[model samples]
Target: MSAPASPQELRKLIAASSWTGPTAGVLDGYQQANLAVVPRDLAFDFLLYCNRNPKPCPVVAVTDPGDPVIRLGRTEADLRTTLPRYRVWQRGELVAEPTDITAYWRDDSVGFLLGCSHTWEGPLRTAGVPVPHAADSMAPPVYVTDRPTHPAGRLSGPLVVSMRALPGHLVARAVEVTARYPTGHGAPVHIGDPAGLGIADLSTPDFGPPPRLEPGTVPMFWACGVTPQLVLPNSGAEYVITHYAGHMFIFDHHVDETP
Candidate 1:
């Protein structure tokens, strides 16, 4: 099915557990975010991690400790129920995948809204780049790379990336257009072989389905916000909640406002 008429409408379906699919191509023109909720005590360090590693964890908006409502200028979203699905991690071990996180919301929790690469796909399409996966319900493929992130206090992990196969001809143009939205992961991190990034096989990814490459297309990789999911587990945080793979929280902001 096509994406909802607006982000708000799509979010309502997600809130009610009616739609639990990826938000990759949904609600075009608006920015989408990866959700990460950690204890208030770990907030500053996590924020530092994001700052040091901005490529994969660009900051969109962060909520005050104990505040579920995210306010960015005029738009607001609830951290507890805005995403399509959530993953609960307890001391580095994944414990649950829930549709709504109300029971798990803690007074000490701080929610983070990190930029997702999907935020820029619509802009890329508008610029004449073919981002085939962006118009479907499927989430782009994600993989864990050998690249290490600059760690901060109590957090460390390798980089994670999302990939999309683009026509060889438009690769340069795709790079130029996507670079304009740094908040949406900016540009491709790898333009050719996946082996350089230590990916053994394109058919198998840590998240999402295997990509279908068309003739004359090249697989492009981008630093992904999902990197924190890998880090949170490695850091062994007491408890954390994050959006499931491919699923995201939609934000009202447009790409035009990004620097």
Candidate 2:
């Protein structure tokens, strides 16, 4: 496989449509974010939801209503066209999957950027933890769990998680590498058995592909960025916008080094 692109290079690649798949292997050192668009009226409550559930919904940045420019992360990045794809939601249902959101822009719309697992992938790989999905060029498997998150206003729902398989012996090292990047969903929430987290099967994921669990490997689960979308119904927002699974908003902020 080719060497991964740098963050800025990945941005250019994404802009040029040279890399339209997941941001997993691109941008080896920078942070990638999950997207959430809500009306200005419900921004506070959604922000509260993020604050209350840092594990699954770490708030990386927020955009002013009607402004597509993300000031806090990737100042030059436009929310309208930066990501490879977007998902449009109306009245709690997915209405469209588009690459650009310029058509949906509204004067009352606000954007929220949340931390994603891409931030931790590099560290894990460097430490020889073997992120199978990233290594094999596949998206991490995601599932909705039975665990409910703390509610804020109308925002409430079960937590969503992404899975990665690693050798049983290196599981602790995998946790150590990821624990250093707490903003990137931190460490695994559930390991070993998917059933422990109310997840019934590994072959069927709520999003992305089923994981290939190599012999001697154990499945590890981390809070997913998709958790926000799952919670959108409870948020009561009439409309919303988010990046497609594995497609993320590239940001300018440096990844946090502390746990």
RMSD of each: 2.1, 2.7
User: Model 1, stretches more than 4 Å misplaced?
Assistant: 1-3, 16-20
The TM-score that candidate 1 achieves is 0.91
Error of 2 at 107 (Å): 1.1
Off by over 4 Å in 2: 1-19, 253-259
Q: Write the per-residue lDDT of candidate 2 for residues 1-259, one digit (tens) a residue.
A: 3444455666666666666677776766577889998989888899998999999998878887888888763356778778888899888788899877899989998988888888988878788777777777687889999899898888888999988878778989988988888679998899988888899999999899877777887888999888888888555578988889888877665575321
Each model's TM-score?
A: 0.91, 0.90
lDDT by residue for model 1 over 82-102, one digit each (tens)? 898999999988999998999
Residue 244, candidate 1: Cα error in Å is: 1.6
**Candidate that scores best on TM-score:** 1
lDDT of 1 at 74: 53
Best by lDDT: 1
Q: Please, what is the whole-model Cα lDDT of each candidate in the order they appear?
A: 0.86, 0.82
Residue 245 lDDT in candidate 2: 81
